[model samples]
Target: MTNFNGFQKLIAIANEYGIICYATPEECLVASLPGYDDFLLAFSWSGAFEGEPPEHELIAISIQDITKEVTVAAWQIPTYLFGNVLRQAQMLVTAHQDFVLRTNNP
Candidate 1:
């Protein structure tokens, strides 16, 4: 089940952004865009039912800095929505990096 190519690519994105990147047997990857103080993304593999494998789930988590409390936002994206999430992350991270670069340069 974990052999899915898309899963590997998603995990690669997590690694690229230096998120909490350790793959467990439960088959999950977690990530956050670099520029934000309170944001998170996670992918989890679900067990198959009947003969068809279950679609993986992508969710957003919110965490508090002081209290260390976690709250998962209301989102459960299937494979179809994966690209949108990935694209959003890329855009955000890139913009923030550019901002930091300019700030440092000046």
Candidate 2:
């Protein structure tokens, strides 16, 4: 079912932002942001009836800080809202990377 072109397109979009994603044997999509190892995005889909396949998906983002031993989770997100959420996540990661670069250079 994940062979759908749309799925591939989503993977491509993630890759464009330096996010690596793969499908698990159970069909869940797991993504990781390069250079920001603390954040993870996991996408899962349901609502398949009679093998008709699901038209929408759910997303969950997990953020962990090992130094502080804290974990933040955002889950049960609909795909319709994923675009904005993804963009925000990307911006946050980019900002963090920029901060790291500046601090290391100074």
Q: Compute the lDDT of residue 44 as modeled in candidate 1.
A: 57
Candidate 1 regions with alpha-carbon error over 4 angstroms: 1-22, 47-67, 86-106
Candidate 2 local lDDT, residue 96: 57
Put down candidate 2 lDDT per residue, 1-106, tens digits, no spaces.
3556656655655566556678778665677644556666655543333644243554455444334454444455545555565666657656655776798998
Tens digits of per-residue lDDT for model 1, 1-106: 3567756865665555456555656666655544554545556544323654334443432222222344323245554455466556545545655775798999
The numbered model that scores best in lDDT is: 2
- Candidate 2 off by > 4 Å: 1-19, 46-71, 87-106
- Whole-model lDDT per candidate: 0.51, 0.56
Lowest lDDT sum, 10 consecutive residues, model 2, at 46-55
Clashing residue pairs in candidate 2, if any? none
**Residue 62, model 2, lDDT:** 48
* C-alpha positional error of residue 13 in candidate 1 after TM-score superposition, expressed in Å: 7.5
Among all candidates shown, the one with the greatest TM-score: 2
